[model samples]
Target: MTTVRGTIRSTNTIPADGHGDDQSTARARAVDGLELTGYDVVQTNTLSSTAAGNITVRAVARSTEIQPHEASGPNYGAARAAYLQTIPDGWISLGITVNA
Candidate 1:
């Protein structure tokens, strides 16, 4: 089994329409080492916005370690579920405060 842990931070400009550039923020952080050992980041809190100042996301990631041979169809499914189950479905941004 392999265990992975990391921190993720997302930031974006707040938009009036409630749409912000969360994609770039997530992408940037993804490479920072938030991705799990045997899993990948399917999505980030992008659809949500920091329309007020800046969209910020901070999460402490923890994932179970699965072996390659052990990763059968059912195991893969369980992994997927375990990963997706942690993230929130939707988020509502109120405001943001930019720094620097």
Candidate 2:
């Protein structure tokens, strides 16, 4: 089994109207997408700051077959490719951890 834990941090400027619901929705969609790709999400931690217009989401996902890899030089190319394809646009991968 392999465990992949990571913090995905993003900052979006709140509109003048202060409608940040869309940002929240986007974050949810990103997590959902990961689940759809066959990872089981074990835990999630979210933090948002209205004053700073910043949002940080941390999720831990586990998979029996998939292995984690370093972003600089990924040993599991297919896993990395799947992750890249799964993540929604506009969301950045801030950090990742893999445990076997």
Q: What CA RMSD would you report for each candidate?
A: 17.3, 13.5
lDDT of each: 0.35, 0.46
lDDT of 2 by residue, 1-100 (tens): 3444454433221211112344565356446545434445655555554555555454555542333333322345554555555555444566666654
What is the TM-score (0 to 1) of candidate 1?
0.26
Q: What are the TM-scores, per candidate, against the unseen true structure? A: 0.26, 0.30
Worst 10 residues of 1 by lDDT: 91-100
Predicted model with the maximum lDDT = 2
Model 2: residues with Cα > 4 Å off, grouped in runs = 1-4, 15-75
Q: Candidate 1's residue-wise lDDT over 5-91, tens digit each?
A: 222223222211122256455446543545455434344443344556344443333333332211112344554444334433332
**True-structure lDDT of candidate 2:** 0.46
Task: Give model 2 RMSD, 1 decimal.
Answer: 13.5
